[model samples]
Target: MAALWPLWGLSPGGSFWQRFAFWADALDPLLLLAPADEIRRSRLLLQNSGKTLSEPIQDDQMRKAFLLSLSSVHPDTDKIIPVLFRPPAFLPICLPLVIVSSLHLQAKATFFSQFVFHSYTTGFALINGNSTTKAEEYSVQEKQIFYSLGAISYAACIGAFPLVFMNRYTMKSPLMELIVRKLLPAPLLGLMSAFTVAVVRSPEFEHGIEVVDRNGKVVGVSQKAGEKAVRETALSRGVLFGTTFFLPNVLTYFVQRAKLAKTPRNLAVVRMLFTTLVLGGMLPASLSMFPQRGEIKRADLETEILSSTEEPVLFYNRGI
Candidate 1:
C-alpha cells in the first residue's frame, strides 16, 4: 500500500469503474494496454483483504513485475520515475502554460529573440570564466553591449527582414522558397549566434577561461585553449540554430503544398503548430549534444600553463 501511493494521481475516482474510466481517458491512444494491465493487477491484489494497494507487495517477483509495468518508469532508471516527471517538477502540467492573447504574440517573440543571445552570452562568460579568472572575465555592461549589437544585427537581417519580405514569396518553385526562406536564414542565424558569442567573448580568447585540476584548484589559463572552447561553443550554437530552425521550416514548405493544406487558413495554422513542435523538441536536444565540460591535454596548453602543473589532464567549460 505504501509503495503504490504515488500512482493515485494517475487515477481520477474512488471505485473500479471510475478507475477504469480514468485509465481509459489518460491512456488514450494507449500503447499495448500496459496501463490497463497494471491497474487490473493492482485492483486484484487490493481485493477483499481490505488492504490498500499502497501496501508493499510481499511477493518479490510480483513487485518487480508491477513496477516494470508502470507507464512513468524509464527503462534505464531501474524502473523508477525520473525526478523531472515527479509532482514537484511541474512540467507535464506546465506544457499548456502559454500566452493565449494573440495581441502580445509579436512582442513576446521579439523579446525572446533578443533575450536569448544576451542570456547565452552572459552565461557563457560567467560559467566559462570563473570568478577568479580576470583574463576570461567581461564586465556585465560589455557583455550587454556586444549582445545588443550581435542580436540586433541577427534579428534584423536573419529574423525580421525575411518575415517582412518573404511573407508572400514570389518564387515560383516551392523548392526555391524552401531554399530562400528556410535553409538560407537558418544557417545564417546560426552563424550569427556563434558570431555573437565570439564577439561578446573575444577577450576570453585573448586571455583565457579558467583551467582546473582534479583538486578543483586553478592551474593556469591558455589563450589557444580558450579559442578552442569558444569556437566549439559557437559552432554548437550555430549548428543548433541551423538544424532546429531550418530543417522544420524546409519540411513545412514542402508539406504545405500537399493536399492537407489546400486552403490558406489551414496551411497557416498547420505551419504554426508544426513549427512550434519542431522548435520545442529540437532546440533542447541539439543544445545538449555538446560536451559541457571539455577536456584538454597537457601538450595543447601554452608553456606557462603547461609548466605551472605536472597534471596531464585539464578541463574547461564549453559554454552553451
Candidate 2:
C-alpha cells in the first residue's frame, strides 16, 4: 500500500491504466465480491450428508440472500455509493494540493507562477482597488502599513470561502471517513489562513467596536462586552476550522494504526508541529505590520510608509 501511494501521486504522461494503476489496486478488492454461491454449495453438500437435504437447501438460499443484501445488489443504492464515488472522486483533489503546497517552499516562483496560471489565474490580483494618490510620494513606513492591512483582509476572506461551500457538500458525501480523508487540507488551509491573517493583522489585545454618541461621546467597548453575541455567530466556525485542520489527520493516523497494529505511529506530534509552525510564522508577522483605518488615510500624507507594507501576506505561508 505504501509503495502504491507514491505512484498514485504521480501525474506523469502515461497510458490510462498506468496513470490509474494505484487507484485500481486500491479499489480492486471492493469491486470484486466473494463467491457466495460456491461457499453455499459446499456447505449444503456437507450438511445433507449429516443432517437433512431440505434444511441445507433452505439454509443455502438464505445465506445467498444475506450476501446479496450486504453487497447491495438489491433495489436501494445505499451500499454501492461508498465504493463508486467517495474515494475515487475525492482523493484526486487532495493529493494534488498537498503536492503543490509542499513544493512551494523549494521552487517558490515557479510553483506560484504555475498555480496562478493553471489554478488561481481568475483569482490573482496584482494591485487591487483604486488608490487615487500616486505611489511615489509616500514614505516607506506608510506604504508598509497599507499593504499589511490589505493582505490580512484578503487572506481572511479567502479562508472563509471554503466553509461557505463545504457545509452542504459534506452532507452529500456517501461516507464520513471518505469526506474527512479527501475534502480536507485546501479549505482548512483557507480558514486557517483567514484566522491567522485576521488575528495577526488585527492589533493584539485590542478587539472592540468603536461607538460615538449623538453628543460626541466616544466609547470603545472591548470584545468581552459583546462576547456572547460574537461567540454565537463564530463558535461553530472556529471549531470547524480547528477540527478540519487537525482532526482528520488525527483520525487517519489512528485508523492506520488500528490496521497496521505493529507499526510505529508518532506522526501526530509532527503534524501538530508543522501546523503550529505555519500558523505562527506567517500569520503573526503579516498582521503585526498591517495598517489601521487611520494609517490608510495617512498614506496620502506619506507614500514611502505605504509602499513598505505593500508586499504580499501570502508570501509567508502559501496555504500549506
Candidate 3:
C-alpha cells in the first residue's frame, strides 16, 4: 500500500483533474464492504507486485486491490482506519448529515443535526491525521475525548447560531432573514469545519509528526511539518463544506425565483438533490487540492533535520 501511494496522488505535481479521477475511483463505497480476507489478499498482491518496480502493473485486479487498500488502510501507520471514518465511507455518511443540517429545521433539531455532523467529522479528522508517531504522553483516550467534545460543541454552536439568533430576534425584512438563515450558514459551516480539524488535530501541532526524505526515510520529527499538514487539511476541508453548504442554497434561490419547484415538497426534494450532487463533486475536488504526501523545502524545517539530510525537499502525509 505504501509503495502505491505515489501512483494514487500522494506524489507531487498532478493536475486537479488527475487527482480527482484518482479519488473518484479510490473512494468507491463498495470497497468499504470488502471482507478482511479480501483486503489482506489485495495488500499481498500489491506488495508482491510492488517489489519489482516503482509502479504496480496496471491490471483490473491490481487496480481493485489498490483502491481497496487505499480506501481501507492508513498510509502513515498501515493500520485499518475505522470503517465510518475511511474516505470511502465519507460521502455516504456525511452527505445525509450535511443535507439534514442544512435544512430549515427547528432550532433544537438543527442543533442536534449539527452536533452529529461535527461529531462524525471530528472522528474522521482524528483517525485520518498523519500522527502515527504522536508522542506517547498524548496517547491517553481522555485527551482524545476532550478534543473531540470541544470540536463538536464549537461546530454545533456555530452551525446553529444563525438560526437561533433569527428565532430570538425576529427580522423585519424577508431579505435580511434569508441572508441570515440561508447565506450565513455555508460560510460558517466552512469556517467551523476548518476549525474542527485544527482543534481535533491540536496534538499533532504540539508534538510534531515524522518527516521523510525523498527515499522515504524518517529523518526526525518536526513541528513545522505537522503544522503544514494540519493547515493544508483544514484548508481543503473549508473549501469542501463551505462550497457544499453554499452552492446548493444559491441554486435553490434561483430555482425558487424561476418557480422551478412550486410546491414545498418539490422544492425540498430538489434542494436535497442539489446538495447531494455538490457534495459528491466537491468532496473529491477538495481532497485533491493538495498532494496527500505533501512537500516542504528542507530550509524551512528545523536546523537539526536540515543538518541530518542532504535532500532539499521533505514529504509528509497531508491527511484527507
Q: Pick the candidate with the highest TM-score.
A: 3
User: Which scores higher on lDDT, 1 or 3?
Assistant: 3
Q: Which stretches of candidate 1 lie over 4 Å from their true place?
A: 1-132, 135-147, 158-179
Give candidate 2's TM-score.
0.22
Query: On residues 1-320, what C-alpha lDDT tens digit does candidate 1 reach at each position?
Result: 22332332222334545434333332322323345456456444533223332343456544434333333332112243333332212212222221111111243453455344434433443333322245323464466466556654564355444444545554437776555544565666666667766766666676576776644456776677678777877776667555655665666668776676788777667655655565455444443454444568988998888889998977665543
| Tens digits of lDDT, candidate 2, 1-320 | 11111111111113434323323332223423435454344334433333221122235444333233222221111223232223222223333433334221322332343243223211111111111112232442254356455554454344333333445455445465344334554454445433432332232113332221212122222232122222222232234234435544565457566764344344444444454444333222222222111111222212443344432210100110
lDDT accuracy of residue 257 in candidate 3: 96
39-154 in candidate 3: lDDT tens per residue?
A: 87877776666433234345877777777887888887777877889998999999999999988887789889999999999899988986645557557346767988988998
TM values, all candidates: 0.54, 0.22, 0.92
Quality of model 1 by C-alpha lDDT: 0.49
Candidate 1 TM-score, C-alpha based: 0.54
Candidate 2: list runs displaced more than 4 Å.
1-143, 168-320
Q: Candidate 3: where are CA atoms >4 Å away? A: 1-13, 51-60, 132-134, 137-141
Per-candidate clashes, comma-separated: 5, 23, 0
Clashing pairs in 1: 1-54, 1-55, 1-56, 2-54, 2-55
RMSD of each: 14.8, 26.8, 2.5
Report lDDT per candidate: 0.49, 0.31, 0.81
- Candidates 1 and 2 compared: the better one by lDDT is 1
